[model samples]
Target chain A: MSRFPAARLAGVAALALLGFLLPRLLGGSAHVYDTLTTIAIFSAMSYGLDIILSDLGEISLAHTAFFATGAYAAAILVVNYGESAWVGLAGAVIAALALALVLGLITLRTREFAFSLVTYAAAVVCMNIAANWDFLGGSDGIVGIPPLALTLGRFSFVAGRPAQFWPVAYLLLLFVLYVVARFRRSRLGQAALMVHMNPRLAAMCGLDANQVRLHVFLVSAPISALAGWLYAFQRAYVGTDLFDTYFLVLMLTGVILAGRRLLLGPLFGTALLLGQKNFASLGAYGDALVLGTVLVGVLCLCPRGLASLWRRRAIPGPEAPSLPGGPVSG
Target chain B: MNVAQQFANGIIIGHAYALVAVGWTLLLGAARLVNFGHGQMYMMGAFVAWWLMSATGLPYAAAVPLAVLVGALLGALMQRLFLRLTLSQDLVNLMIATLGFGQILQGAAGLAFGAKPERLTSPLQAITLGGARVSCSAQDVLLVGATIVVFLGLHWVLRRSRFGAAVRMVAEDPPLAALYGLRVAPVYLAIFAFEGAAVAFAATLVAPRTPILTSIGFEQVVMTFVVVVLGGIGSVGGSYVAGLLLGLYTAFFSALVSPAYTTASVFALLIVVMVVRPGKLAASGGFAR
Candidate 1:
């Protein structure tokens, strides 16, 4: 009855096996599953966003800024310096994390919406710069990114083929989820949840709100940046479209409209979104009409998220109040 | 014609931004909820007014009133349906919802009108004044003049009216306002609607001059934020002054520096402002966790 950790392990193990088997079972054609792989990449990024949104309850509007920063950094290194894909990916993660840390320092000082605005502003600035700089392919984006490679494992994204990337991709997802779950189960995890529950109380209990925010925010960026690195690698392309308003909206849409309750919310949301690519040709408004309407309906009706509808509950009269701004528990 | 002309252009552009920013400041002053859809209302005003002139064969005079009405109506609906329900709720949720709503609007507009830019057709013709060219038509004048009147009217209402006192009470503290016999709910809705209209009016003022594109709303939203930030959050004068200043900043920056640097410069200034005085550039209420 109480095999929580073991259950968690089993769940993760099943997920890893599924990810590993996904391409081989669904391969031989670059269709829905291929798109699904890309969706998985977004799900990976959403996991990063979860550090702030799900665990800590911070509303970061400018996540794409860091993601784009990672992508552009990787794009610049590879496209300009003729660096190896591994080198570019490493630079992207480090640069994106560094930028996120610096930004978090300034924004973490402010509370909710102000932090969101600061992040949005940062994203806009990065976008404007990217659009203007012709050197990094400017608005057209830096295309022709090379694939991945491992030294001893002899794994190369190029030689590995789409089928070859299955293990690498699954491994990346497994590592991300395992690390996040571990962190959530750690002292820092409680501290983070505590910060979300009530920062003032957390402060009263000798927790530094700013410090917690900085750590969570810092952690959030690398995961998102890693998503960006994977985005460039998997898509074999990176463009200005990835940094614009549409993309930014997608991140939030993935989070709020879907991922409000469950940890895997973004994955489901992205899968739904990407699955509608075929419907885009229905009209100019196309999938947006459906997506936006669904989003509004969800927020208006089911603030906890669409995933909540399927879950079971026990004796739900009135739970205690959430930390001041936590999702109104009662 | 010259650098001075560029300066004047910047100032004129800045003034328009100030008008929109002032609307933002007013709503923020009232409810402490930042309406992301405010820019959409602005774009709508412009487009709708343009439609009346071109399609309905209405004069600039008729179009102005029609546009204002549309702006006000849309604003009220947004509040009644969206903002009022979400007041004191998660700011992030509201922001994301607005983005979703805005996307729906964009997609619809793209379907209805097309993605290409549409120029407002009016009796007004371009003519030179004071060694500079201005659209001497009634449309341009109406746009500029409407902003002036709206600003003055807003100042009067905020300062002197009984309703203004109630609005101020609610803005300063909603629960406290209830203690004073003011109904906070209606006020929030009213303030949201009022600001939405004001922004719509500004958009109409803008739409006649600039071409309308489905994508323009995206940039305008950020620009509005810049105006609000530089204007000192809820301060009316701050918003008014900041909008014009930012407009001037953008215009001259584009003229003297590269066009690409114009948007970036404002953001850089925002970063500087954030670093120097985080409290000064604060969003509505307190953004604390």
Candidate 2:
């Protein structure tokens, strides 16, 4: 265990390379490109929630709001201001961070149900505002967002089609994964884990629980928002529909189905979900049923998630502190 | 904008809110559990009553009790499914499970009832109170009267009954209650079942005021959150008073400002309350404390 295990790392890298090429290898159809691009985008969106649920040990129903904030920010900038993808991306990040700061502060002192409900309320309010406020395009939303334009000195790319959008989506997913991986190893990440696992210890170690929560939220929101930024370019339209509960349920299902804390769990989970929705074709209602069932089944039957099913001695003991309504006073 | 009219509107809306929120208040009071599927349950109740009235030629009043029965069954089923989590006191998972149930209910309702909204017509809606000065329908009057009855009944049951004592004991500490051999499981089940019945009753009364849609579940009960949270989590009487206050706030805010942004404004008010009274919120759920 102490050794570098270079061969294992190489094998994992090779597998990732094969995954990256598999879509291209299989006929490269338009449907495949669109489907895969969606998986990538949705998976990226889920990672923002992954950190909050897994590391911070908090459920944030407002990530949908952040996702919308990103999509709207990008669309408004690109469509109204005639800005490029870079500016849209920046605008998306800024919008998400601002919203997160406010939400995080509002919920800093809340726990469990209160925190979740507050976040849910915030998301609902965001939807209400986006739907009613004309400046944000009201219910019509910002439409006809231009194709993504990214220019790094001489290097340039314009992705107007789903096929052309694949690399961009793939790259965004990779960047988000990298960010998440780094986050798990960062000081804040460790602090968050401590705070979640043992608040007493976290306090004894001189960490402010609320501050850590706020910081993590600030970081997590942009990850989802960036996904929304790319999604706006792909769809060429951003509407209040971005605030739909479908995305919220999907994000939750993705994060939990494949297990929490695993770097590629959300990616795998999103791929599996989109694969079912795309290929299997359960009508809207059926798909919702499937998503809902998966969330409930996993949480009820295997709280550690499906990943635990593969391992021996995988059942998490009930001795672990329960977050919902356990003895934890606050 | 007659002041009396607005006040009348506030009372009607306030009663509706309190009735809708009462089940949740009881559930929270008994267990620290939350049903994200609550609004969907309300939707289900309305649809069931509407279906009964339409399909079986049942009167609106007769269909309400039947709808409440179905709501009670749903609550029992949810409690059964979530019994493990409830026993373990695993709130996070329980919350998510409730969310999943809500989604399933919403999706199923959409398929069963279709996408378009349907009005739950009541005979009482035809009976108007006044000419044009500050009129309200008989349905609105029934709603206010029903809310008062429900609240008074709940208060009596909770404060003056042995079952109420058992529930409060469990709410204070399930493990301790169980240790004292108070049958914790039954208490949890009863509270959940009550939540279902109470929300359904609220639906039959309040849903008549507007069109019922499958997707309105979460949004429908958003105000319930304000009522329950502001009224002090599990406080029965507090929920009623809070509902009235929220009703007044909504009535005045929409009448004076913009109706479109009333939800947003209510949520803003909720956030302000949380910010100012974080400790108070944290201290919620402790029955005697």
**Per-residue lDDT of A330 in model 1:** 10
Candidate 1's TM-score reads: 0.89
Per-model DockQ: 0.51, 0.58
Give the range of the ten consecutive residues with the poorest summed lDDT in model 1 chain B.
B127-136
**Number of the top candidate by lDDT?**
2
Against the true structure, whose TM-score is highest? Answer: 2
* Per-residue lDDT over B1-289 for candidate 2, one digit per residue giving the tens place of the 0 to 100 score: 7888999899899999999999998887778888899999999999999989998999987999999999999999889989988888787878888999988888888777788889999999989987677899999999999999999998888878999889888888889998998888888899999999999999999998999988888687689988988888888888899999999999999999999999999998998888787765763553421
For all candidates, the clash counts are 7, 1
**lDDT of each residue in A1-330, candidate 1, tens digit only:** 256989977886787777667656765465644565666677677777777877777667667877877787787887779887678778988987788887887786777667767777677777777787897678788887777555546543452355555555556666677778787887888898888777788989999888988888877888888778777777667877777565665666677656464656776786677667542434636566566666666766666676555542544567535432235311
Give me the runs in candidate 1 sitting further than 4 Å from their true place.
Answer: A1-8, A22-29, A147-167, A258-261, A278-284, A310-330, B1-3, B54-60, B87-89, B132-143, B178-181, B283-289
Off by over 4 Å in 2: A5-9, A313-330, B283-289
TM-scores vs. true structure, each candidate: 0.89, 0.96
- Taking the tens digit of each residue's C-alpha lDDT, what string does model 1 give over B20-61? 766677776666666666666677777778778888888876
lDDT, candidates in the order shown: 0.70, 0.88
Where does candidate 2 clash, by residue pair?
A324-B91
* Model 2 / residue A197 / CA error / Å: 0.8
Who wins the DockQ comparison? Answer: 2
